[model samples]
Target: MLLKGKTVMVTGGSSGIGQAIAIGAAREGADVAFSYWGSDEGALKTKEAILETGQKALAISGDVALPESAISFVQETVEVLGKVDVFVSNAGICPFHSFLDMPAEIFERTMRVNLHGAYYMVQAAANQMVAQKTGGSIIAISSISALVGGEYQTHYTPTKAGLLSLMQSTAIALGKHNIRCNAILPGTIETEINRDDLADASKRSYMEARTPLGRLGKPEDLVGPAVFLASDMSQYVTGASLLVDGGMFVNLQ
Candidate 1:
């Protein structure tokens, strides 16, 4: 039990990679609390799975796009599950839109949810950790898009890239408090956000061929990496971006 007697809070944990991370933490003996935007059904399912592991679970419904909501969520987590030992800022949105067709409203909304929301969550978590005087870990779920540009992700990729910079800054600012911050850059994982894109045979084949592993990554593929960052195994690691992209980032061809 890498996280025995710990408490973990995850955002956007109702489904996909976030869901997997929440469940994985619970299995490692960490009580889990997660936030969901609007999916009661999905949130309930994730809560049930975490409870099945014999770890307490709290499912909070709120919009991370609002700073107040993010602050409130963290406060609620502390009130229920005690101090958060690990905070995963995984709530984000990636909408495909060609640069020429992108609307200003859409772009702003993306930044609000992906970058600003993460900022609030990280700030709140760090404050709580400092208050408790217990060092903690903060994991930001970024993406390969942050490394390389995407044709339809001009608006989306920047937010992901911003996360890396945010983590670095937080790592430096919070190190004295013993709080570590890192980013997890996942490859083209098969998730609800990218399901339609991956379903296209041509795009799917292109992605698989480009990836050295010859397959698109699954949500489960990220569980181990996330757990490593959250646990004491990575006590000395901070301000780093761990890529879990199945070698796609290195395949130049």
Candidate 2:
């Protein structure tokens, strides 16, 4: 009951890490809402799960990459939930290609969603948190790619790296207002997005062998840290990143 009576929003909540964070919040006794740009079916399923946990849920449909969409989502969620106690900017895309040969559009689109979208969400949510004067938490789902450069992942790496800096800057500015901002850099979480990309045998084996944990990360593995960041458990913590990469960053081989 760490988050009892609190309200939270998770973008990309239909699946993957976003879905996991939303469910985790509900289980911790928080009212939840989440945004999904894709399938309504997945969003509906997540909604049902949230309801079963006895938490209210608002399944919003929108693209986080668009400023208007991000603003609209924040406005609508506040209308329904009264106030947002936590916001997790989890929506992103990673389509890898050689840096020299990558298409301009793909790179631009990735920057739009992964970096710009997060900026807007933080602005929207932070504004609300300031108005409420109740303080809140903001967690951005970053990646290990930001820390370690990898071949063919140039676009993704910079955006994820931007998230870490964004978290630090926001945490400093919002500290006096009692709003906390942090990033969770997870390594190789077992999500459909990654699954699709790992169809190549070489990529699959590389990630597995590189991770010291001897296994790929699960979406559920992020639950504890998400809850911690969203709850008072991290009240004294801000301007930091909790790297949940199972030693991926330290394996330097």
All models, RMSD in angstroms: 0.7, 1.1
User: What TM-score does structure 2 among the candidates reach?
Assistant: 0.97
lDDT, candidate 2, 1-253, per-residue tens: 9999999999999998999889989999999989998889989988998999999999999988889887888899999999989999999998878988899999999999999999998899999899999999999999987788978789889999999999999999999999999999999998876787788888778888999988889999998999999999899999989999889889988
- In terms of lDDT, model 2 sits at 0.92
- TM-score per candidate: 0.99, 0.97
Off by over 4 Å in 1: none
lDDT to native, each model: 0.93, 0.92
Ten-residue stretch with the least lDDT total in model 1: 92-101
Instruction: List the candidate 2 regions with Cα displacement exceeding 4 Å.
Output: none
Q: Over the stretch 1-253, how does candidate 1's per-residue lDDT look in tens digits?
A: 9999999999999999999999999999999999998889999999999999999999999999998987899899989987889999999888888899799998999999999999999999899999999899999999988899988888889999999999999999999999999999999999999998888999899989999999999988989999999999999999999999999999997
